[model samples]
Target: MLRWFLAVIGYLFFRFPGAIAGFVLGSLLDNMMGGKTRTFKTSFGPSPTVSPADFELHLLSLASLVIKADGSVSQSELDYVRQYFVQAYGKDRANETFRVFNEVIKKREISAQNICNLLRQRTRYESRLQILHFLFSIASADGRVSEPEVNEIRRMAGYLGVYSQDFESIKAMFFKNPDSAYQILEIDRNATDAQVKDAYRTMAKKYHPDKLQHLDEAHRKGGEEKFKKVQEAYDQIKKERGI
Candidate 1:
C-alpha cells in the first residue's frame, strides 16, 4: 500500500499539474494522519511498508512495554514517558505519541513482531534502543521498580532482535541487579535494618503477581517470572542486610 501510494505520487509529480493537486491533497492527508515523506534508494523497487498508523502503533507498543514492565503503571511513570516524547520529538509529536499510546492501552491484543518490522523499516538500532531506554527510564520514574513493567520489557524485547544476554547487560545499566532487583529500587548497600524492611514492604506490594494475572497467559507468565525474581532479589537483600 505504501509503495503504491508513493508510485502514484511520483508518477503524478512527473506527469502533470494533476499530480500537484494530489500533492496538496496528500499533504493534508499526511498531516491529518501523522506521516512524513522521504526519498528512499531501492535497487528493485519501492520499500515494502505499511501506513503511519502502523508506525504509531509500533512505537506506542514499545512505550507500553516500559509502563507495564513491573506490574503496574503509575502517574509518575507516565509523566516521564511524556517528557521523553517532548525531548525526542517535541510537544506536537509527543501528543501524537500519547494518542497512539492510549489506543494501544485499550487494544485487545498486540504483537511485538509486528512492531519489529515497522522499526526495521522506519528506524536504525540506536534510534530503537533510545526509545526502549526511554521506556525503561519511565518504568522507574517514580524512583521504584514495578514488576509488571519489567515483564513487558522482556516479552517485547525479542521482536527488536535483541539477544537475551545482551538485553540483560543493557538492563543492568538501568536496574542495579538484573538478576535480583530492579535498578530503581536503589536500596543502599549500608542501609539500616528498618530501611531495608521498609524497602521490602514497598516492593512486595508493588510486584504482587495477582494484580496482573488477568493479562493474557503469555503476559501473565512473563509477569510471574519477573515477580518471582523481584521477590528473590528482595529476600536476598534482607538476608544480607539482616532486615
Candidate 2:
C-alpha cells in the first residue's frame, strides 16, 4: 500500500524513474515498520492481537534489555520485574514464564528492534506506551533511572513508534526535574494558560484508565498511574501560575 501510494505520487511528478525510486524508498520504510501494509490505525481500542504467551515473552525480552543497559544487572531490577509479573499474573504462571525467560530468553542475544517491530505490528499504540512505562518502572527499580537506562528506553521508544513528546511524558513520571510537569503534559513551558488547560484535557483523555480495557488488568492499572501523573502535573502548573 505504501509502496503503491508513493509510486503513484512519484509517477505524477517524475514519471517511471521516480515511481521506481519511490517504490524502493517506500519498501525500505515499510520493511522498517514490520511490513504491515494495512491501514495505519492507532487508537486506544483493540488492535491486531498477539497471544498472551507471545506478549509476555516480548515483554520479558524488553525487560532483559533494560536490565543489562547499564552494563550490569541489578538484583533489585530483576526482583522488580519478578514482582510485577507475579502481581499481574499468579505466582505459578509468573514462575513458569520466568523459567522460560531464564532458560531461553536470557541466554540468547535480545534484539530490541525485532521485539519492538513485532509489538508495533501487533499491539495498539496505547499498549506500546504502557510497555514503555513498565520498562521505565524496571529501570528505576533501584531508585534513580540511570542515564544508560534512559538512553536504552529512548531507543526502544523509537523502535516502538512512540512519539518523542509521549516518550518524554512517560520519562518525566520517573524523574523530578524542574520541567517535569510540562514534559508530563507534553507541552512547552512558554505556553499560555489556555494552552496548558487544553494540554491537560488532551493528556487526561489519552491516559485515562478506560482506554486500556481490552488489555490486562496490569496495563489498565498502568494507565491509571499515567492518568494520575497528568493530573498532578496540571495541578502543579496551576498552583505555580496561580490559575
Candidate 3:
C-alpha cells in the first residue's frame, strides 16, 4: 500500500505542481500511513526539490529508530536531541521537531534507506551535525552504549553527511570503549567512595525522565536502565569501602 502510494506520488511530480502538490499529498499519506512528523507552514521559499521542514520531521522519526532499535532509548539520547535541535536550528524548529519525532516513534514507521536519501538531499552543515549528534545521542543515551546502538548510529552517521574522518573522531571519542559507571555519573573512577556516591546522586537527578518534558516512552525506559546502572555502580563501590 505504501509503495504503490509512494510511486503514484512520485509520478505526480511532472503531471502537476510537483512541489506544492507533492508535499501536501505525501504529507497526507504520511499521516494516514502513520508517518511520524509535524506539519510546518510551507512558504514560497525555494530551497530544494525536497522540503527541509519535511526532511527534519523524517530525520527525527528515523532518529527514534536508532534510539529504540536495541530495545532502549535513554534520557541522554533525548537530551542530545533537544540540545542539538536548539544548537543547530533553534527552539521553534525544535518544537516542530518534537511533534513529528514522537509521532513517528509512536506509530513505528521507519524506512532507513528512504530517510537517508532524503536527508542527504535536504540537510547540510548544522542540520547534518544535528543528525550525527542525534545518533551519538542515542548511542550514549543508554549510558553503556550497546553495540547494536553503536552500529545503528554509524549507519545513521553515514546518511547524515558525516565523513569518514569525522566519524572516526566520534567513534574514538564516544564508542571507543565501554563507558564506565563513573563516566555516567560524571566523576572520577578513582574518586573516594563519597565522591562517587555524590556524582551518582547528581546524575540521577539530572537524567530523571520526568525532568525532561516531551520525552517519549522509549527514552524513559532507557533512562531507567541507565539510572539503575548508576545506582548499582555507586552502591558496589560503597560496599567495597564498607561505607
Candidate 4:
C-alpha cells in the first residue's frame, strides 16, 4: 500500500526516478512499521543510514520521556530543552521541533525503553553515549536530579546496553564533586599519577568530538562538551595532587 501510494506520488513528480525512490523509501517505512529489523537503504547504495533529523527527533522524544518521568516537568527543564533546540537548530526549526516534542510528551503510551532499544539498533555506540549525556543534562536542569529521574535514566541506559561505568561517567558530568571527577575519568583515588594521566587520555580519546565527527553538528557538539568535562576532571585531579 505504501509503495503504491509513493509510486503515485513518484509518478506525479519525477517519473521513473521518483518511482524508484518511492519504492526504496516505502520499503524502509514498511520495515520500520512492520517490526522488521532491516537496514534502511536508498536506490543508490547499500549503506544503511538514518537521517540527522530523524536521529534528533528520537533524541527529543526520549528527552520528553525523561522530563515527564517524575510526573511533572520543571520550568527549568523546559527552558533547557528549548534552549537546546534553538542552539542545535535555528529558531525557525526549533519552533517546529518543539511542537513535535510537545506532541511526544503528550503521548504517554510510548515507552522510553522502546525508544532506547530502537536507538541502540540504529545508532553507533558514540551516538548512544551522546544521547545518554543529553538525557542526563535534562535531568539535572532543575538544579537537582530527582530519584525518579535517576531510576528512569538508569533503566533507559540498561535498555540501551550502556555499561554501568559509562553511565556513571556521564552522570558525573552534571553532578560535580571530588569523587565525581574520579568517576568521570573512570579512575581510582589510589591510582598513581601516571595511571590517572593514562585514564584521562583514554577517556579524552573515547569521548572526543573528532570521534563523532561523522554525526550531525549537534551531536558532535554534545560529544565535545563531554570531552571537555573529561579534561576538566583530569585537570582538577592534577591540581589537587600536584601531579
Task: Report the C-alpha lDDT of model 1 over 82-195, residue by residue, as the tens digit.
Answer: 665566456886688778667766776666667765565554343344344445666667886566766677666666655565355335545654343533234655666777
Model 2 lDDT per residue over 1-243, tens place: 778889998999999999999999888876866622333235544456345766787898899989999999999999999988887877998898888877885477888999998888777788788999999999999988899999999999999999999999999999998899999999989999999999999999888888788776777888899999999999999999999
Ranking by TM-score: 2, 4, 1, 3
User: Can you give the lDDT of residue 208 in candidate 3?
Assistant: 54
Q: Model-by-model lDDT, in order?
A: 0.56, 0.87, 0.59, 0.81
Clashing pairs in 3: 36-104, 37-100, 38-100
Give the Å shift of residue 186 in candidate 3.
Answer: 28
- What are the per-residue Cα lDDT tens digits for candidate 3 across 92-115? 977877876767567865777678
Off by over 4 Å in 1: 1-35, 38-57, 100-108, 177-243
Put down candidate 4 lDDT per residue, 147-239, tens digits, no spaces.
888888899999987889999999889886769999998877898999998999899988989877766566688898999999899989999
Model 3 has an lDDT value of 0.59
Worst 10 contiguous positions by lDDT, candidate 2: 35-44
Residue-level error in angstroms, candidate 1, position 233: 22
| TM-scores for every predicted model | 0.49, 0.80, 0.45, 0.76
